[model samples]
Structures are given as structure tokens and as C-alpha cells.
Target: MKEDELHAFLTLQRIPNLGDTSIKRLIARFETAQQVLDQKKESLLKLDGIGAFKLKAFFEKEHRLAAEEELKFIQEHNIDYCSYKDQNYPERLKHCIDGPILLFKRGSKDFSQQRMISIVGTRKVTNHGVDFIKQFVEDLAPLNPLVVSGFAYGVDITAHRAALDQGLDTIAVLAHGLNQIYPKVHAKYVKPVEAQGAFITDFWSSDAFDRTNFLRRNRIIAGMSEATVVIESAEKGGSLVTADIANSYNRDVFAVPGRPGDAQSLGCNNLIKTQKAQLITSAADLIYLLNWQIEEELKPVQKQLFVELNAEEKVICNFLSDVGKEQLDLIALHCKMPTFKVASILLNMELKGVVRPLPGKQFELT
Candidate 1:
């Protein structure tokens, strides 16, 4: 089925008050959306959150209207979507306990990669935090990692634009939908990213961009990545929420150590002091923490494996080997291949175990 249709179906199953946790448990018993729809009202009455009162509302005409409204928004905005059952859905996010039932997307790039990192922090950043972002991004930009972040002010926006400037595929996770880019000032970058990177959200376009949604979106950012980096966060900033989720997900959490008395750095310091986050001085620290080890000997072997490239594959492999890892979309953009063809070759290479997938659709030469 078309992905949007599947998304609508899943959205229907996970209406207000019925979250991913409950939806997952329900699906575990039923085989398909139709089965869930066909389930007897009495049977649903036995389910914990779905008592007779809720079950009646679920199968009502209003419920279908809500789903249709969501679908219409998806179609009109050119916002692609994926349900948890779809292969295109991010595996890392799918593994998350509260992964969204519907992911609203607007971009040519893939969200699921092997080496994903989420960079977050206070909206009111200090100079030190800005410098850290600039330098960290310069080093990380060349590596082409799929940098994930909220499209908020401060450190989050800084990281996204930097990755774009470095010609990397950066995905912004939104609490809203493709139809309305929150903090509308970021609208310009959103289009370019839609062409080059990606824009992902869980809430339908019809849904308001509520305060609670951005808080919920932070968990997706943390859960989808291999690690979460807080450039500089205030005592009560949203970055701390992302860090907390990262810790709970067992994903690495790193913070840029900042000077004392900097209000923006308080949350970061608190995290490190409490042993909640590791101190990171550079992108190398992140590279090391992820244990993305590519031995020196693997270089020659990689060269030999793709020996028949007409100078192009040789160049790409050389870049990849030296760089360690890169988003596959960046590779295809760099190699000038259609995304589908690049995906095909990467899949082949993966099957041969020649390369490994990283979070954010990145691939690293082994």
C-alpha cells in the first residue's frame, strides 16, 4: 500500500489518548488495522484503556473524519509519511518505546541511517556555545553524519545550518507538521533541506503545535540517534529533556563543558557533574564515544573491494574511508547517483558486509 495510506490507518488506530505504548499492545494481538477495526466492541471493552465508552467513540464517524482530515493535510502539503510497519520507518525510532504512530515528512533524504547524532541546547546561547557549535560542526560536517535537532532557536538552528553549509544531509525533527514550520523564520532552510536533507514530525498538520508536542518530539530526537550532544543548556531548557531521554534510551549523552557562571551552560554542567553526561571537547570525542573504529588496515581492503570503479567509486571510497562515516544521501549527492540506485548499491554492499549502516542513514566503511 502507499505509505500515506498506511500512515492514515495507523493514525486512526492511535487517536488522542491512545499512545504508541497502547497502540503497540493492541497491534500485538490483532494482525492488521482492519482486524482492529473489526474487533468486537465487547472484546475491546476488556482492553485496559479501551473500555466500552472509548470503543464506541473509536468506531464512530467522527474518528474516521479525524483520520481523513489528517490524510488530506498529508496529501496537500506534499508531506510524505510512514507508519511503524513500513520499512522506510526509522528502525531506531521504531525500537523506541514511544515511537510515533505516524511520521510526517518533507524531504528527499532518508531519516533512518546508521550514524545519527542529535545536537541540542539552550535557545539563548553564549559565545562559548556558539564557538563550540561552529568548530564541532566543521569537523563533523566533513564526516557527513546525519545531524538531527529541533528547529528551535539557538544551538539547534546553529547545528542545522552548519551541517547544510558543510553540504551534509541534516534532518530537523519537528513537533508540528510539514505544513507549518514552527518558528516560521526557519522556512527558507526547510525547503532546501526538503530538497537535500529531511524534515520529520509526528503530529498531523491539523494538530496544533502545542507545548507538550515539542517536549514529546525531543524524545524522538534522542531515541533516533546513536548519541545526544548538548552544546550548552540552561538549567530549565528543553535540551535537558532530550538528554534525559537519551540517557533512558541508553544512547550516549555528551555535553560541551562550558565556563562557570555562564547561565546557558548550567544544565550541561549539572548533567556532567551528576554523571548523567560525558564531557565532550570535540567531535573526536563523539567519534570515540560511539566506538566507530575503522582500523588502518581496512583502508587497503576497501580499495581492493571496489577496484573496478571508473575512478568515481575509488574517489567515493577514499573519501568515505578517510571520513569514517557519512549519510548515504550525502554519498549519493556527492557521487551524483539517483537516491534509489545508491540505496540499491548500499543494500548490496551491506549484504556483503562490506559496510555498516549508521543512524540517520549513514554508512561507514568497515
Candidate 2:
């Protein structure tokens, strides 16, 4: 909780006159933070990126006490400051371009894990997606991999909650700092996650929840994880950006399939069909695709299609899945059959475990 090293780092970050590229230039010449700060105006003028104008701007805006206050706040809150030199820094992310000079974390769990997976998707999830998430988490949790997510609503929240529910550590990579949590409604779940996992960010406490931070944070999620799974997403969504980043880093990407008509699922379906991601039907598929080893033995559930109806059952299953449950009359119209025959077929299908009959003569694909 001491603040000296953190305060110096924060002070260097707040130097308005110098950007990350410029800092790199300066660091290449200087040995330590103190050495760079101690250099006189004459020595500072010798740097390539720091000319007279920027040098003047740097000194004019410099305030030691303000930087000290930011450091104090971080310490008072029990937030840990991890530098590039910190052994605990994630090695995968360290090699990433535009990597942060430091990271701020609030949690008991280590960010470095042997196996890591990031789950990202749309904020508005469908009932179909909820079932996908539950099954995925239950299967992967036993592997003891670090599950990372944005902690947003829908798929993001669902993945995090499921990981925690299964007694696995899950990291919530925040857009802002630990100073304040965005989408405040999630506060109830966020706190307990810290005790078991972590909330991490590249920005310091002073950085606001700006638009660019979210995009910047996406890289961390991709960098830290070995692979990413997009459960459900829109054509244009933040989750796609993470998948792109993961692909750029040569990490594997997977997407769950949904009906083509489902708007929320279109993104995932497109990704798989377009060959941008592998098609994942179950958590077993993901484990196999990633070649992840589970400590506990995992056996794929044998699926048996019962009561063959002379090609009719296959057509009905595909039809209902695409358009959702169908009433007896609607099914007869779509299948071009008589209502009485449709009812009889549906009853037979239900008895054979091919479909589930609902109230009002509606039938669902099992």
C-alpha cells in the first residue's frame, strides 16, 4: 500500500506535454523515473520529441502535490499498482502493442493463469443465449481457467456470474479505474467478484470513463486470454472488436450458432459461416478446439434422435428452431399437411423425445 513508486509513475503519466511514444524515447535514454525527473532543462531539451514548446508545457503543468494525492487515493483504497517491471504482470499482454506502462487492480486473485478465456457478446441476451452460457460455464469451470469479461449486461454479466457461481476466479476488466464502477447497477455483483477475482484497468484513478478507454481495455481482455468466445453479438458491437483483437494476436475465436432470424445472434452466426470463427455447439467443442485439458474427466453426452418420422421430424426440428415454437395449425400450414395429421405427428414426436409439446398445442424443438 505504500505510495512512493506509484506516485512517481502517476506523475510521469500526467505529463501532458509527453505522450507514450515520447516517454518511450525518454526512458530509452534514462535509467529510472528519478533520473528522468532529475535531468535539468538543458538535458531535457536534448530529447527528440521534447522540443522547446513541449518542454515549456511540461514544466508549466507539472504539480507534485496533485500527483501525490492521486497516489494517496490509490493506497487508501487498497488498490495494487503493477508496473511493467512487476513479476506479476501478464507476459502475454506485455508483448502486445500499446501495452500499458502500469496496471491498477483490486482483487485477491492473480491475473496470470495457465489457461485463460474471455467471454464477450451483446448486452441484450436471448433465452437461447442464457442456456448457452450456463452450459459453457459449467463445463469450463472445472478446468480452472481464468474467465475474463467486460462485466456489462447480457452475455458479459452472465459469463462472470456463472464463473463465480462455479467457484472459479473471474476477472472483470474495467473501462475506467477502481475509483468508480460504470453501469452502477452491477455494484451488487462486482464487490464479491473482487474478493475471489479482480477488477483491472490500465488507466489511473484520474482517468474518466471516456469513450476511448473502452476500446483500449478491449485489448487487455484479448491479450490476457488464450482464446475468446462470443456467445451472442450484433453485426456492429464491442464484442466483435475484442474478437478482432484476439485474432490479430493469433488467439483462437469461437462463436455459438443461433437461428438466422435472431437479430442478436446474427453476428455470431456470420462469424462462423464466414470462417472468421470456429462453430461451437457446446463447451465440449470449445475445450477440444482449444485443446484445453480438464482435471476432471469430461465425457460428451450422447445425443440420440428418437422416433424417426420419415424425414418429417428433421424438417420440423429445423423449422421450429428457426421460427421458434409453432402452433398445430401453423405447423400444418408451414408443412403443407392437414391439421389433424399435424396434431397426430406432433403427439408422436413428443412421445419420441424429438420435440416438446407446449400449452395451446404449440410444439418446440427439443
**Predictions in order: lDDT:** 0.76, 0.77
- Measured by TM-score, the strongest candidate is 1
For residues 162-211, what per-residue lDDT tens digits would candidate 1 score against the true structure?
A: 88877777889998766777798887787778776888888766667688
**What TM-score should be assigned to candidate 1?**
0.78
Q: Which regions of candidate 1 are displaced past 4 Å?
A: 2-14, 294-366
lDDT of 2 at 188: 95
Off by over 4 Å in 2: 1-3, 17-25, 40-54, 61-63, 296-366
Task: Count clashing residue pairs per candidate.
Answer: 11, 0
The sequence of per-residue lDDT tens digits that candidate 2 reaches over residues 155-273 is 98899898988888899999987888878999998777988899998776777678878788898899888899999998888898898899888889999888888899889998888
